[model samples]
Target: MNFDAFITCAVTGSGQSHKKSDKVPVTPKQIAEACIEAAKEGAAIAHIHVRDPETGAPARDVALYKEVVDRVRSSDTDVILNLTAGMGGDLILGNVESPLPLGNGTDMAGATERVAHVEELLPEICTLDCGTMNFAEADYVMTNTPGMLRAMAARIRDCGVKPEVEVFDTGHLWLCKELVDEGLILNDPVLVQLCMGIPYGAPNDPNSLMAMVNNIPKDWVFSMFTIGRMQLPYVAQAVLTGGNVRVGLEDNIWLEKGVKASNGDLVARANTILSAMNVNILTPAEVRAKLNLKKRG
Candidate 1:
């Protein structure tokens, strides 16, 4: 079991969670506030995703990202910034009978275009989703081809930023290994996030979680999280399995059945869980040293 772990608060996701809960940050200012709040609540890192201010829709606009990053960097609180490089790979297909043209939600982009924000902002860490898979949406697929992943990884590495490899299944983990072997992901103790319980990917079951955990390179650093009610429980599950923890509005919006959660609430709860277990929560500086990250403005 991991007695020393760090919590990563995914401040906002590229999803419609804002429609479900008003607490989910939409504008760049709101998103920056959420990250600062989480940092104050003991989250070592803030995994951020900016949304359209007017529509609350997920956006990859560099200007929006600049606002969020700028606000966080200018804040009094200190937290490791982790920007999402998982956008621009959505692939929503048409009806099964006629899959000729892609659906409206398809926002695929070239590797360079996808990593443009990362290259520009140069966050301490960015995510690199390792593989492609069908999502819960009937016609949508979270598309990330091998070539695209390699290109993105190379670019992220070139920026002197750590790539938090996101793995949803065993195959994704396998592909991550391949990336490491190819030296595209050159971090000595590679960082990985084992995303669990998201519809069609790896389930939140213990066996499945262990299956993915067992395959991770022993020296590599990995954190685990699941969506909805399971998010809190996975804090313990992840720690007991010798991994770190992640929690925030991105993956789960509810603090309880009837109550909504802000990013701080989720981070606080995860902090309580870890405290009860007598685990040490690492600080942003400690996490940077552990992951060999390059902090930037």
Candidate 2:
């Protein structure tokens, strides 16, 4: 088990969770403020995703991303910024029989367009989903093909930002190696986030987490997280598995059943949990040095 771990708060995701809780930040100001709050509450990194302020849906608007980044960068509090480049790859099929025409929520795009924010803003880190999956068991499929991934990884490298490889299943981990082998990933200790318990991805169990962790290259730095209630438990599970932890309203909004939580609340809880277990919760500066990330302009 890793005695020292860093906490990442995924502030808001590309999901329609605002309807369930008003605490989920929608506007850029709110999102930025929440990120700052999480950082102040002991979160080393804030994984960000923007949403349409009016509609409260996922968005790929560069302007929105810029507003959030600017807000955070100009703030007194310091936190590692990680923008999601996993958008604009949605392929919502009409049905199993008639999948060609596509349906609503399908905002697929080319690789360059997908990473527009990273190119323009140059966040310290951005997420590169290792592989695609039938997201949430819905008709929509998150499409990240190998060729597209190669192109995207190359672009992220060019921008002088680190890509946090997101692995949903064991196969995704293999693909991550392939990217590294092909010279796409260049970090000394490659950053990887094990996205467990999402739909048909890797299950949120100790054995499953260990299976994925055991296979990872010894030098790679990995963090593990799960959705809903499993989110908190994974905090301990991840540290015990010799990995880091992730939490926030994005993965799980409930501090408890029928209780809503903000990004700060979740981060504070994870810090409390880690403190109780005698684990050292790392700071942003510590995480930056450990991950070898350069703060961008």
Candidate 3:
């Protein structure tokens, strides 16, 4: 079991979570404040995704990212920043009868265009989804082809940022190893996030989680998380299985059945869980040292 683990607070995800929980941050100021609050509550890293302040829709505006990053950096709170590079690859196909025209939600872009924010802001870490898969929606698919992943990984490396390889299934883990073998992932100990319980990804069952874990390279670092009601429980499961933990409004909104949760609440709860298990929660600086991460502006 992992005696020491770090919690990554996914402050705001690029989803319609704001509609479900008023506590989910939408505007740049609110998002940054959420990150700081999570840090104060013992989260070592804040995983961020910006949105349209007016509409509460997911957005890829570089200006918005700059505002959020600048606000967090200027704050007294110290937390590692991890931006989402998983935004621009969304794909919603046209109706099944006639699939010639792409759907309105299709937002595919070139590799460089996808990581524009990573190039400019240069966060300490960014996410690289390892493979394409049919996401939750009926017609939607998360498209991250091998070619696109390689290109994006190369660019993120050039920016001196660590790419947190996000693996949704066993195949994605294989692709992650291939990237490591090809020398695209340059970090001394490659970092990975096992995203379990997504609709079409790896199931959250212990066996499935173990399948993903067993395939990981011995030297790599990984964190595990699941969505919805299982989020809190997985905190213990993750540590017991020799992995770190992740929790925040991004993955799960409700703290309990009839209650809503804030980012700080989630981080604090994870901290309590970890502390109870005699697992030490690593600080942001400690996580940097463990992952061999380079902190930049």
Which pairs of residues collide in model 3?
A: none
C-alpha lDDT score of every prediction, in listed order: 0.93, 0.92, 0.93
lDDT of 1 by residue, 1-297 (tens): 999999999988999999999999999999999999999999999999999899998999999999999999999999999999999999888878887598887898999999899999999989999999888888898999999999999999888889999999889999999999999999578999999998899999999999999898789999999999999999999999999999999999999899999999999999999999999999999998898877776
Which pairs of residues have clashing backbones in candidate 2? none
Candidate 1: which stretches are off by over 4 Å?
Answer: none
At residue 226, give the lDDT of candidate 1.
98
- Per-residue lDDT tens digits of candidate 2, residues 1-297? 899899999999988789889999999999999999999999999999999999999999999999999999999999999999999898889888888788988899999999999999999999999898976655888899999999999999988899999999999999999999988998577999999999889888879988999999888899989999989999999998899999988889899888899999999999999999999989888998999999775
Q: How good is model 1 by TM-score?
A: 0.99
If candidate 2 were superposed on the true structure by all CA atoms, what would the RMSD be? Answer: 0.9
lDDT per residue for candidate 3 within 1-297, as digits (tens), equals 999999999998988889998999999999999999999999999999999999999999999999999999988888999999999999888878877588997888899999999999999999999999987687899999999999999999888999999999999999998898899997489999999999899999999999999998889899989999999999999999999999999999989899999999999999999999999999999999999888765
- TM-score of candidate 2 to 2 decimals: 0.98
C-alpha displacement of 63 in model 1, angstroms? 0.6
Model 1: residue 151 alpha-carbon error in angstroms: 0.9
* Cα-lDDT of candidate 3: 0.93
